[model samples]
Target: MSVEEEDCPPLLETCAGERGNEDDDSDGWDEMEVSGEQTTCLFCPLQFHTIAVALDHCRSDHNFDLLSLKAKYDMDCYSYIKMINYIRLQKPHPKILTESSVALWEDDVYLKPGDMETWLMYDFDDLGSAPSTPHYAIDGKAPISNLSFSDLQRQIQELTIQLKHKDMLLENCHKDMEHMRKVTKTIVDSGDSLNKKIPNNVISSGCDSSDYFNSYSHFGIHHDMLNDAVRTEGYRDAIYKNIKMFAGKIVLDVGCGTGILSMFSARAGAEKVIGVDQSEVLYKAMDIIRENNLQDKIHLIKGQLERVNLPEDKVDIIISEWMGYFLLFEGMLDSVIHARDTFLKPDGLILPNRCNISIVGVDDIDRYNKVVNFWDDVYGFSMKCMKSEVLREAFVEIVPPEKVITNSVILTEIDIRTCDVNACIFSSTFTLSAHKDGMLTAIAGYFDTFFDLETEVRFSTGPHATRTHWQQTLFYLPDTIVVKKGDRLEGTVSCTRLTKNVRGLSVTITIGKNKYHYSLD
Candidate 1:
């Protein structure tokens, strides 16, 4: 054993007196001397018979300062030479030093159980005495000592797990946003396509005024039936001609208003003719079928095309006069598509295969004066209370010629026979440019349809077209602005179809040399 190891008490020797004297006879020490050592340690003190026994006791119990002991002994006294050197530099004895010296030598001290226990009870006052030192700073700069490499590895693993979870959450959020965007786009497009400005008074089966059509003949006959004498002769002649050509073929009559078209098909020698309509209009059609005594040849069913119960690929011909005020007013063409898909064979024919909208400009001087006077009253006051109400009323009255722009300029004509309603996305945009400058008056718009075999319905710039309960819709410019003949009126009208029945349409107009614009919802 080295001189240093011999001088410092071994850990086992310090606690030996606490145990009963099992080696009392082996050691030469008397009972009084052992008791004195026990009093110093406040426990049992160790006994030694030889140098080897003392060295073994120090190694086993004290974790002795081996490098210091080795310097006094031979260099080869400790088998682990590097371990001894490491302990000499890193582990320092706190008992031999003052409190101030111990604090200054903190970096050289090893963490011991006694030191840890003392730290648990250490007060803030003791910590403040060691200024310029971090309270939690551990002794030594070695990673193994300061950070505990195993604990650090476990923390890294936990962070990786948390990161993976966050990435999955982010991916899910992205998918949800994409789905919401698609749904919103669908709704907006549908709103655009089915919007129309048909007059509230026009009696149509699907419109709000459908109930009025029942008693409408008291005021005026249905527009399609107005030319009854001509329609009857034409129907009879067409039926005779078609029946001879298509003997034993099945036929369908869409919007079979009074079943007149179905009757014509039955008379045309069709093997089967089915008439479908949503309104009690089918009842009227039944009456016509009975009056013509063709009930056995025709079958009448009541349902909308969207939910119509019909067998697929069964009919050879589809016939109907489903046109509304401006070609799409009541969204009747949708029903026609449904009928075509459900009943018609691949080679089936559609009556009135193509319909084109024709528009013309007409002068309405009275409407201009009304709109100007109304705006004047509004501007004269500061309230601005009735702007929306005024705008609504103004759009309904006074069909001015300037509002009429030809489809040739703005729209592509619809071919009902070849058009696939499912695959199609419809958009209608209008750019209104001023043709001539005058006191801005009312704007008017109208339409005409061209059917097969030179048959036509001309809703013209005449008294009857304008006088009917379903008059052309109109919009009056806000206030009269003095405009030059060449001044441009720039605006756009846009429409997107959501479904067969629902559509969205908006018109934006700019009038003036400098182009003042306004939008109507």
Candidate 2:
């Protein structure tokens, strides 16, 4: 440990004190009062007369040695203060501290002093004053140690109150966790013998927004979309057919995955095209734009629409292929809406300005048996217990037109040019009359986009239309319901955005007295 210390100098005083004089107060130790003041044990509720005795109790009772921890982490004065405060306020188990690779107190919130004020004690300072310890020296004296006793006491009181508010927030978060756990367990029954363990990431709170954006960084997702003729041609024709509107106009493409739409606009004689994305895919997109010789006409920016700047003051048109499965699954429309509100001119056109989400009943027993019943006998192992979880998530697949048993009903239509973010979460009731007598095993959803220009270019992902990358989203029922030729199924379908993961959707379909819930994540 002594050799390691010589190899690496300790962090300087400015580590936390850089904030202001408030941090300097951490070092104003009044040894006379500090040595006699009563303190609590770090890992337990026991009290000691002095910080030295309290540390000794921690080493013996909890196997937590402060000196050894300092040596292992190469901690400096600020780290020591942070560690003392963390253990006092968070009450974390000693094992968790031992597993850390670094001090793990780099977060400024941990620098705030807690009630213990353990840094004021001599035993804590002894570690910093040791000859073998590395510390920033100024004429053989540390600047913080010269602070007056009163300044330290006042600073501690202010810092302690600040930490109390943080503690309250943490308590509320714990309550929210408990509530979500109960709600999730109720949504999916816990008695399934095949599935007993529920990992923390399965909970919505465990999801990070970065994980959602990082998914688009991969090549396969782009490859699938680029290879889909129906999807690519829809955007291509929308720009080419409305050449009069796109010619000599500035266009902004939000959530531009591979800069395809930007290049399309450039090909349509746009004066300039700006494509913005917040994923690693933008690096490759830069190379793609240069390779196509469209670099002079297109500029690719890497950031969210709300934060990034566009070269033009206001664009004359905005082109984006932001549709997801079931029309609004990934919530990419929110980004497009933000771009519209921030960068587009008052009369700017949004390519594919209109979109329609429709629902149609499907009579595909083969798919139902393959997805759900296949679990009943997986190599003769009776895995029917896994069916409950399988039924909770919607599937994106193609259902043949012949299998559709009812006429399509338009659930909702979104005008991208005028819609806000809240419009994405919507509910609509529909009554689908069966055109032929058949067993309705699932409800399939598809969307159609309209350019609404002079040519009015439009494309559909419905079962009767040409297939696209977003084939169709299917929600299979637990049991097939029999229907006559003229029978109508009355129900309400609602799409809601999940609180924790904004990109994820929670869908509920109610048919008469039965309600089915599913997640699109």
The candidate maximizing TM-score is 2
lDDT tens string, model 1, 57-169? Answer: 65566644333443433333122232222223323232221111111112111221121111121122232133423222233112223223353454446557778778998
Tens-digit per-residue lDDT, 380-407, candidate 2: 7999889989998899999999999998
Off by over 4 Å in 2: 1-209
lDDT for 173 (candidate 2): 78
lDDT score of model 1? 0.45
| lDDT of each candidate versus the true structure | 0.45, 0.76
**In candidate 1, how many Å is residue 267 off?**
4.1
TM per prediction: 0.46, 0.61
TM-score of 2: 0.61
Error of 2 at 97 (Å): 47
